[model samples]
Target: MSNDILRLNIPPEEPNLDPNTVCKTYPELSQEQYSLCFEHPDVTASAIQGIQVAIHECQHQLKEYRWNCSSLEKKNKNPHASPLLERGYKETAFAYAISAAGVTHQVAKACSLGKLKSCGCDMSLHGKIRQKWEWGGCSHNVEFGEDFSKKFLDSKERKARDIHGRINIHNNRAGRLAVIKNVNRQCKCHGMSGSCELRTCWKATPEFREVGKRLRRKYEKARKVDILNKATARYRRIRKQTRRTELVYYERSPNYCDPNPLVDSPGTSGRLCNKTSDGVDNCETLCCGRGYNTLRVRRTERCDCKFHWCCYVVCQTCHYNEWVTVCK
Candidate 1:
């Protein structure tokens, strides 16, 4: 594989990957897995979309948090260097969840887009099959997506029996489950004389943002698990006691406010913060007892609008000053 292939393996990279030659792009993946990625042309597209969706959704989900998921770029570039991987932090859970969800969302969409030759829109609905209603819309083929994601993403942890390995597998599956659970039926009513006699419904996939939101909720409620004899049944029992939908971790996250290059902490210095709110964006709490600086910012906007003539309207430009806060 070439540098392009290596660069395209993870998210935040340009999504200009060629669909036909994706498998050859990732030399890190096992030969068997590499071949599997190209087993069908649709897999290529889905795989690319998966990486993009994971990073984009994760960044959006953590936009307000102190760390803001920016550590993902480094983690993706060097998986072993990631602090999240070494410790079961909330950030680690988010990473696993977003990556799995991305693959799940893309595979389902690719199936509906006619990219997958083996499966099209879902036709297993009882109403459509029984002729109670017409299947006039494309359904998200979540079944295929879930299966494919399991086979592909889980393969990464196949040889590992460590606690981190097990946690990764669990989190990844949780992400996939979030996507499958969010699939809903979207229907349209149709009948002669506008009567409510028949309907056509299709399984629709939720926006990737919804999946991210669900995972974020899981991250908040993530459980700390103990690795007791990871090779024995006791470990399985302990892990099984936790809810499968909840993200499982082994350690608490570090205080990300301080600069710690060893763990990829960028620190909150110079970070923009909101002075008007008490949320995560609040300057005081985000700066971790470190003082902040307030600056007067000038801004312009279209302030006044007036109707003109028959079809047009115009607005007047206005200037305003606002106070902005930043971590010092």
Candidate 2:
């Protein structure tokens, strides 16, 4: 399990780039990376990319949920009562998952795209055991990604022994593992006369949507785990049984229907809900028994496209009426 081939060649900072400014401008960069800012100056771009991608993926995944993962965008002016800091909530699980996935995907992508000076296309698998396909293409370096993500994101929990800390670390690892597990392998066939003889293959990380989908599934089946004393062997047994891909929690989540300014929950008031469906997004459930307001609106769209002449196409504009339901 040696990761000797996954090292990063972080270079000294450019004369014009200030490490302090980078940290101040992008608050999402982990403290671990900030500490090593002088050595790895180029991490600024990667950090920003990771945070943006993570937030986007989280919102996309939770679009149908009551909370909709909106807490991730909060400035956390008062960090003491941050909504996303909850330990046992499904939102917290998603936050950790996407954060890890973002960092892993971005780092590997940056390496492949030559955007970062620290690394390049994964060479770790280039000279390994013989296989049917040759590893000649630019493969996403999941090993380097996982190693760097753990070092940066899990550094805060290195000496943490509490249950919450362990839970956070576990969820973070789950996020990174999800990305690595879902890597899609693509191959190019090479032979004479279209006959299959040899293949050039490479591994690529799936879209963040895939990562979010897997994490959401994990959220649905999340387990309530017991936090036992380190002195007891039961603790070891439970830790061993917890799978890396599973989301773990210790307590029930708070009802997000009530507006809790303390936790930054804005409640579901005025939030749009589906009027016809019987799912969680249905107005009956999403409105939280507060009743819903139905409104009719004119929707305008272009339809009946027809190609005219050689270069242009014409479409007709149509107006239709539809109803939108919102929580009262």
Candidate 3:
């Protein structure tokens, strides 16, 4: 199995015990990540949640597209299915960024919510903003989250020092920056009669959905980079010139319309497609002009729900026929 901690071969339900046992529990983690877990002690649980959040958001953002982030799907049949992650496609770049962002976001939120003992609400606020409003609310300590994410997520890549490693590092940083850039100022009023007399504001991370949208936009405008080893002078020059927030990738993706087991791409065949809409999910775009098969099927659902005078609710079983289109 790959050493990637984010892979679908998740560790089984962890028994609640102690922080010092993290290394022993998650043996799949790289040596560097294990060491970081050992040092922080309290951040490992949150980091695991971060990965799950990243995967969920990725699936949500790409649900309408052809690729649909299916390579990351967890299946009992294919525990080692991660060829897409092995490539340097723009999709891979997105995965890296979103995953890192997930870690940074989750960790920061954990700190603010008192879930992590090592950290708490960000205390770095200063300057003209403090002059206007009191920083009393819990601000997500994103800076600390970003730093910790870099130390742990980027650890495996640091050991490689190859072109792939550089690309991963760049995209990972872009993910962290996405979280930082989207931090919003949230405030609450303390006046009795809902008056604007006093306001206390604190920095808050944007909803993860918003972060997913931001990263999706970056994926659409991803920069195609020339592949090169870290030792090359051209590689250094490109690294210096590239913008920090831009997503960069070296390899072109193989248009995920057809299943390619080689890359773990479970193509669009047999996928449901909308026949009438002109969106990316429509049959014309999703099926890649192979045409789709329409089947009339009856669906049974609970409808006509009514609330009784007391508290209980009742619903009637309804049957309806609909035309379902599937990619050929």
Query: Which candidate has the top score in lDDT?
Result: 3
Give the per-residue lDDT of model 1 (tens digit) for 33-146: 566666753464465447555765676788778887666553225232456555667788778777888778887877787756667877676344435566668888888888
Best by TM-score: 3
Worst 10 residues of 1 by lDDT: 304-313
Local lDDT at 229 for model 1 = 51
Query: What is the C-alpha local distance difference test score of each model?
Result: 0.69, 0.67, 0.76
lDDT by residue (206-313, candidate 3, tens digit) is 988899999999999999887544345255766787899999988889989898978778999987899888789999999989999988988786555432211123
TM-score result, candidate 1? 0.78
lDDT of 3: 0.76
Model 2 clashing residue pairs (backbone): none
| Candidate rank order under TM-score | 3, 2, 1
| Candidate 2 segments whose C-alpha is farther than 4 A from its true place | 1-21, 28-31, 74-81, 127-132, 191-197, 227-237, 297-322
Model 1 scores what on Cα lDDT? Answer: 0.69
User: For residues 46-70, could you state the per-residue lDDT of candidate 2 as single tens digits?
Assistant: 6444655676567777777787766
